[model samples]
Target: MQSTLSGRGFRPGDVHTLIVPLFHVTGLNTIMPTAFHQGATLVVTAQQSPRDILALIERHCATTFFAVPTTMILLAQTPGVEQHDVSSLRLIAYSGAPMPLRAIQRLRELFPGVRLHNFFGLTETTSVTTVLPDEQALVRPESVGLPPPGIELKIVDDHGDPLPANAIGELLVKGPSVVKSYHNRPEASAEVIVDGWLHTGDTASLDEEGYLFLQGRKKERVIVAGENVYPVEVENVLTRHPAVAEVAVIGRPHAILGEVVKALSCCDPTPTLTSGR
Candidate 1:
């Protein structure tokens, strides 16, 4: 994806303006090549402060930027970020974690005209899936998105049979971008990449329109009296209480139901629990 992005006309020819940290997978595989392949400048940074990144963008007139969700948030909130001449930034690729709706909206407000793409993948997969174009980033925030051109996706049940579309199941990915095996670990390779499928262990469902919606991890679900309970659902509900700042729900052992829901909550700064008392 980086190589393909680098070939665009907007990229500078200097080759030193493409900012990246060389030790990471994105730097080694995506950031560095995008610059080298395009003959664009690569900008190496010692630190990742929002101010520093914006300065590089202004100084180099960089046409593209790629970063994780956390960094993006920090940049948007930075004091002087808006003062920089960042109009040259045409493309911004973000991954590492799902961009929450709030963060996505904030980025749109910050960069009104820049293109944004969300990519999803593990290190072993070498970044196989990408959500392309700025539209999908806002319209379908949940989907990690369609597999990159060469990648294939399989949603299957516990028995390995392909489940119907829109059904929740384990996600399996296979493609040229993925690593065939772990370094010096045959057993680990066998456990993950079995028979051409890399079991993601994440629970997700597809919509009728084929957009994927990720639920929490498969292991996070609890079986209570044969009914499946997702802690996130309960937590989401409890968070609506004005006094609640944050909450976590877990499955607790129960003599009758085998398992029961237990909730732990952190109250707001000025909590008022007098009504319940």
Candidate 2:
């Protein structure tokens, strides 16, 4: 059988370690299908420990591991991670959430030979929509890369008018991968899927080269005095600091600005947002 998965560079019969939950789209729709299509072996472990996962990768000589940012950070910062021979890992794909630039650099340090890929998609999109290649991973760390084959992506304004390149707007996707509707909720299905395009509800932009950049969710945008502020951008910058472990930016009520950026953060030992800077 011919494979439509051409752009992806996984070996013909490589081994993969399933880090994400099997019920999740990353594992269910993406990893499982890919492994079956490529005729590769998949390593599954009940316990989700850094040590156990790493050990399995070594035992299976897994060439690929698909996980989110937190798992990536934990695996990289695992106690005595060097003790595990994860040199077999060639491709590290991350999705679900934003991978801070600092973490990306750490991954590079931990696995020099591996190619890091940032994937962007929702459960509604089935799995992956665009992929930031290793070549441009560092160069455009924020970008989620261009669409894969058989997918059509575009940015549109509030009126559903298509926006030009680099203009931030709602990202709409049209392709075979997109679901026709929700199981029973016709109202929800109608609201989200309009005119054959899936309104992703994500505030994003496409660059001149067709690279996709996701700012955040449209409803999550914090407008401070008529200026748009994306929480993810602020969160990315916050995570760059050594002390910060996690951060969540939100839009809070403000009398003047309509909304203001409110960042809730946590750090190991203690957290002082002002002191570190």
**Most accurate candidate by TM-score:** 2
Q: Candidate 1: deviation at residue 255, Å?
A: 5.3
Off by over 4 Å in 1: 1-21, 229-277
Please report, in order, the local distance difference test score of every candidate based on alpha carbons: 0.70, 0.84
Candidate 2 has a TM-score of 0.91
- Cα-based RMSD of candidate 1: 4.3
RMSD to the hidden true structure, all candidates: 4.3, 2.4
lDDT of 2 at 261: 84
Question: Which numbered prediction scores highest in lDDT against the true structure?
Answer: 2
TM-score (C-alpha) between model 1 and the true structure: 0.78
Candidate 2: residue 50 Cα off by (Å):
1.2
